[model samples]
Target: MTDTLLPESDAGNTSDAVHEDRLWCDNGWTARVIKNEDDDGWAVEMIKDGEAEPALVGPWTMGRDKKNPKPLDIGAFNTLVKTASEVLRRHEQQLHAQLHKRLTVESGDGSVEVTLDIVPDEDDPYALLTAFDALGEQLAQVKVAPNFKLSRAGAASWVENGFRRPG
Candidate 1:
């Protein structure tokens, strides 16, 4: 497939560097200002290298002529890269939180730490329910459905039930 590259501006420097009027490629990312298809205004998209889709897209400021988009400068490109990188970082953090969990509950024996670590397999998604004694000795571990709702009452009940696989 033929790739359509934006015209290089006079600011173009080294082979790996591209500082153009409406396009920039640097720091493993590319920022491009394009006419918004949903509206008459323009939009800016920040895409990481080798990614088919942009990581971030937002409205672009208008130029002095009002009809044209403002040039993509070094400062703007840096800000876009920061914002897009932050977006990806936050997304990864959220996914991690969803896959791992820990909770502490008071059982008749003592305080037990419970954990649920989900394995997001394409065909066999499941979670491991584990219990540990206050001294850090693993009490039991069982494979449960990924959607199992771990709660204080559920954990206490499981501990009280002798740590058999939660049915």
Candidate 2:
């Protein structure tokens, strides 16, 4: 049954819902409604793309109106799916980005190359840029502060000017 939008509670009991429809997400995860066969409960299984098993499994319930959930509607279901997907996506993305990440930049003279390895620091969640030569010798290393952002040219200039740290 997919005619209604499951309330936050029902969304929690994804295993009991009958005829569960799967919600596709842009963040490389798939959410599916499944009857919790063991307990006859409603539940949702969120699985990562290309993975055989679900990354998360939770229960889903019907909306407060107690509408029969069947024949999932594309519009309403999409919105719910999108919201949930985004949260998972953000979490996965942040986790990955927190791991050892590198940003490389080539020097104007081609004599040096800069590799930025971003590490998460509670006090300063930024990266450290290690400038190295083609010969694989470290040249310069600087800590990119938490307030640092390279997306904005003004921010970059600020870092270059000593007003901020390059991130």
Candidate 3:
């Protein structure tokens, strides 16, 4: 796509910088085309501000000669930013799904909603197990190990055991 200069607000406060034919920086992100290490083709990397690694890295298009990489342009940069932002969003969603779980269990009193949320930290990982009565009043909240298993059966057992931490 042809290069299109973005509006000042969209491009942020910094002036757009074109480092080379294959690299451009704008709107707090950098798009760079590099030689593919696995193949003779080219690949593009999109890195956001203050990030040590690229949020997206994928194959790049070849130039008209089919040897050099296609030159970076405003349109290409904008597309790359959109793509890389989507990748980051999906990754965060997946991680949140993995770390948080919810279930409903039938108890003698009524149905209870149970939720297990894990905080995944490199140095200190932990989980919080919480239970709420049918009316949405919290019954109990306990800190558990990060690896604690959460399931319908486990929730039922916890409710039956007076909301005590399961061994």
Whole-model lDDT values for every prediction: 0.87, 0.54, 0.87
Candidate 2, residues 50-125: lDDT per residue as tens digits?
A: 8786666666665455543233344534455666667678878988775544443444434444444667667757
Candidate 2 runs further than 4 Å off: 1-31, 37-40, 62-71, 101-167
**Deviating ranges (above 4 Å) for candidate 1:** 1-15
Candidate 1 TM-score over all chains jointly: 0.83
Angstrom error of the Cα, residue 61, model 2: value is 2.7
Model 3 per-residue lDDT tens digits across residues 68-111: 99898767777898999999999999998999999998888888
TM-score of 2: 0.36
> Each prediction's TM-score against the native?
0.83, 0.36, 0.89
User: In model 3, what is the error at residue 33, expressed in angstroms?
Assistant: 0.6
For model 1, how does the per-residue alpha-carbon lDDT over 1-167 read when each residue is reduced to its tens digit? 11334335523533576678888887678898999998889999999999999989999999999999998876687789899999989989999999999999998888999999999999999999999999999999999999998998999999999998888
